[model samples]
Target: MADEGTSTKPVRPSMGSMRSSSFLQDHQQYRPPNKPENHYGIDTVVEDIQASQISSPRQISPFNGIPSSENPPKIVESGVTHEFSHPNCTPAPGSRTDRLVATLFYRSSAPRISNAIPSPQRVPSPPRAPHSPKISALDADIPPTMAPSSSLETFPLEPPSSEPEPLDHLYGSHISPMCITSFLHLMSTFPLPPNSPSPTSAHRCLKLSAAHENHPEVVELTLSPAPSADYLSLADLRKHELIYRFEQEWNVDVALRADTLWRRYPRLVVFDMDSTLITQEVIDLLAATITDPPDLAARVADITHRAMLGELEFDSAFRERVKLLTGLSGEIFTQLRQVLEVTNGVRPLLRALKKLGVKTAVLSGGFLPLTSWLAGELGIDYAHANEVVIDEATGRLTGEVKGRIVGKERKKELLLEIAEKEGIDLQQVVAVGDGANDLLMMEAAGLGVAWNAKPRVQMEAGARLNGESLLDLLHLFGFTEEEIQQLVA
Candidate 1:
């Protein structure tokens, strides 16, 4: 089959040829060290045929008759042997050559053929993009510096600034009628404004005035003209609004000022005695004094509730309830007085008010006997209420009211009278109550406080206290805890 002048002697093979030949022979007879019982040697005939094919490239495959020299074997670490053709050789599906190649490399532990030839030293992969830690949805809007720390040692601390930073300019301020604890905490983050009005100069602005001993609740300060000049941004405003609007646990209310809170301090404080100063409604307790009549107490209580809710006219309700108590002995007032409960925080509140020279008056729609007694007990300066008529002969209730019914209109008139008598301006008076009857007086005062009042009263009140104590009212007036403690001490 040789052509004339063509050399029949085999061409000298390269080093790769010698190594692949030896490896093939060694692998043909090889058995795994762990399984010496198995033998995987190829038959002599097949070995001879494969060697001839390797020697002569033309005899490798019959389909395309490709030369073996063009397509060499590449050994990869994955235990799969790949045959690389000159351009490329794609074995046809189900072909005899494809099956033969598959059988030759079936899960064999043979050494990689590429190891025989030196490969270019591996070039390391480029460093991956710096990892970005994911943030929680709730904290996505928070600054990275403010994010929660996993460990105390890893927490970042701010380095001291080389230069002193200017104070945050005053934008606007709001005083919550509730507790000052949260408000004080919020203010700790920002420094007090510079060149801001002082207590003495605050009175000059007429919009805001300095906090004084008389009006500890008043905080009057000037704001920068430009909103953007202040450290409190619009977002911070929104946050403050949310905090104020949803604060329910504390009983204080809030008042906002764009410029100042320049107003005279309250010189007089008029209280609705029944429920404002005292926890019990005097009329309800009086009715409860009728022990002999089971249904009488319940009936009087219903009328009292309706009148406070504005469902019934106070005068008519008072008369109806008083009529039910006609047969009761006058001694019942003594029993009722023994069980009267004072509103929480009233003692401290009164003491604070008294020290500030704020006069107090109790305008009650209940009986005068109890109102006057409560006034003396609480050290209140003035007391006014409707009188319950008592028969001198029997020493028992006459089932009638004496003097004018101290209804809603009368209460308002009394408030004006008291202010005038005290020689104080109407604007310098504070009124606190919980019923429809007291609304007129409440409206007449400079500061109207609805103390755990009906919904209607609360809606109209300047400040509403729905919390545990009357002490929060002191906070609204701008009294700090230190000042309060000093006063108490």
Candidate 2:
């Protein structure tokens, strides 16, 4: 594969019926004391009462819904707002007296004003009536220093926008909006475990920060509330839970992980062969070569499943299964490789990875003859597995491992060896496997992806891809749709 690693506020409570008697009583509580220093030339409260009392039955004020008393300095009469008969009411619009009284009026009348304009968390958060008025009050309280001379008319009272705080969990590396959002909604439906909920200010928020998030090829985003500990980090547990959802509900055939960085660029990729790289288990196929005990094939297949499930140890299972093939013909090895079905999307993925110059390897617990052959066919750079001994003269299976069995531990060692030889850090290596034995190496790599792995492995791997095609792996590395096409093409 020519795939190169690619890149990836709460508001205050509203003052309900702000002009209600309760509010006025509270306002009087905090209002400037009636001391000499508090006595300004104009008294808005007294003037408001006087204006209401003086109004005649037939008199129609220019300010219809706006009460004359609510006007701080003077009320508009006959459309002559410019003429103030009282010398004390001639202060400029931004005067402290004007600001103080007008600001109070602006806030107290929110129930009426907000009904005219609904302010949702204008950007990401939904607008709730309880918080909407509080937002307006904040807007009205412009710092006097930041206000202009005609602050009443030119004040920056437009609601200051608040952004979604990124969830502690950050996600990136996706193909499109539909690809990412559907995946997210599916995972979010997963029931969170009983972590004693720690009430924090940053719940239900998110941020989009990927350089190419909206690009047809890549999507990036940051969400909050991730697990802090690295050991069985909440990430791994979530992956386990996500795997359950993938298999059960929602025909979603893909796995989407929320990670700020799944090691943005991986220099090498390693895979396990049996159920991962190919569809048929080589051992089960080899067992089929035996015609005796009619149920021999069935027995070997069961053992293989248990071994992969981690119920039976790999070495013992491999030996027990191989012993059953004591007299198999050598020619079948070549024949087995011929009929091996590559998992969906493997060809294009390998071709893309090769083009990107990422080293690829196969670390198998199966026989080496088929392992190496598969690696060569797929253009993989390295191969390691157990080699079975055969009788030279008869050209048939001897049913014995020639060297140290390349079991779970050996697979991990080989992975580290390959990465070390290439001068790459473990973080730049990706391990893909689907068996209990694959867990060690998967844990050892920077990003361990469970490719349709067993339950145990799925529960522990760093990331899991539930899709049928490995081609989506390209998307995992943050490749754009166009770039993937060019590489595969």
Candidate 3:
């Protein structure tokens, strides 16, 4: 009787239903579109076109419990006249037919989606492809802007494309066709930066040909067809890949000589006795040694200053300065030599050049007595300075110079003559000095380096080494770091 009562009562369906009526009832539940068992119709919402323009195809995947018998992707071909053919698309609740049709309108006649024509859209658009296009020799001739024809031969692996490729696939993204053509035209003018290097030079080339300010470590190698046989400046050569750029600070492009310029120059370099070898106004130094006439010394010094700066003619300036010191003593040479200070970097540079077999020479406009003493001290090889005309009886200045002045033209003639006598080519010569008088000598040599020179000399000379020690000339000669080490050691 108790078991029968428990089963028969139906339990009055209970207070649980009263407390959770909405959760148990199916009235407010959502039924999924194609799955009757799944009460919620969460996937039944229709997707409306945001804009009336054609858009890229959307790929759809099946929702769980939706029948796989239905094909979600409806592929419509361009110009082939596709008909709505979804076999399982039943009519929506309000529609008489199952087809959700979209009318095909002509681009010229249809209302545009926006002010600008969005790039052409197609059904079943392709996924993104690789960066560089694989172009065959035949395909290279084909215009990049044209669509690949609907033939299997066009894109070998891709089957005869059922519809024409979206114009975006043939051309590129939303950019105008005219803009693309302009871009290609511009690219044709200059070679692309990436392909500028030579293949063979790139392989074995450990060194770069040029220097760029931004990339201090990496050498820049610019390769083009070898230049035609014609003369060109360094700038011209750089334009045509004939010369490479070197660091301005490091190489100091003053002169380019034969490979052995350091080896064959003057063994005995002779500088002028006055301003050539020493800073003391030579005539003034002579005056200082002879008498304590500071005023006459200052006047002679001013004349030399004008001459060195190219203000006065060399002959006129020489005559005036010499006339001022007409009656000095021969003993002045000894005093001047003792007091003279050699120019900076002379010792160090001479030592470096001596190691490389360059003997120093000093040709001077001043008296020989002081120069000869300097020759022995600095190990100079040759000394060609003026001889003071002394009274043979008294050993006093006779108010006259003994030899021809070592002026501009004479200096040049002497440089070439000395080069020939030393068995060195003129091209292997390196001249260094700091005056307008030195300009002719500098031009006569292979590498004329103006050392802390006046502006006029620097402008006329081949290379100028200003505000730097003379030892910097070693770098100009292409000395390797290791070679410099051995030389210095």
Estimate every model's Cα lDDT from 0 to 1.
0.61, 0.63, 0.50
The number of the candidate with the highest lDDT is: 2
After TM-score superposition, the amount by which residue 181's alpha carbon in candidate 2 deviates from its true location, in angstroms, is 7.7
Worst 10 residues of 1 by lDDT: 98-107
Candidate 1 regions with alpha-carbon error over 4 angstroms: 1-252, 255-264
Arranged by TM-score with the best first, the candidates are 2, 1, 3
lDDT of 3 by residue, 1-489 (tens): 576546554555556635522333335555446744423233222222332234368665444443333434343455464434433334347743211110011111111111121122223234434333342222122233334454435544532212222332233222223323332332234332342222111101111112322211111121122222234332233223111121111221223222232433344343443443555556666655544465777777777778888888776677667767766766777766668877766676677778878756776666667778888887777776666687877877777776787677777777777777888776677677777887888777765666656768756666555532454555555443345556666
Better of 1 and 2 by lDDT: 2
Question: Model 1's lDDT to the true fold?
Answer: 0.61
lDDT of 2 at 189: 46
User: Which regions of candidate 2 fall more than 4 Å away from where they truly are?
Assistant: 1-220, 224-262
Model 1 Cα lDDT, one tens digit per residue, 399-423: 8998899999999999999988889
Clashes of 2: 16
Q: How close is candidate 3 to the true structure, as a TM-score?
A: 0.48
Q: Output the better candidate (2/3) by lDDT.
A: 2
Clash count for candidate 3 is 22
Candidate 2, 1-489: lDDT as tens digits: 445684333567886675543334445544465544333224444545443323246665454353233343455566676533332233347642110000000011122212122223223334456435344433432233333334366546664443222111123222334434544554454343345232111111121223544432223332323323343444544555554443233222233334434345778999998778997799889888788989999999999999999999889889988888988998899988768999988899899988888999999988888998888888999999888888999999888878789899988889888988999988788899999999999889887788877888877776666655667667566565567789899
Residue 195 miss distance in model 1 (angstroms) = 23
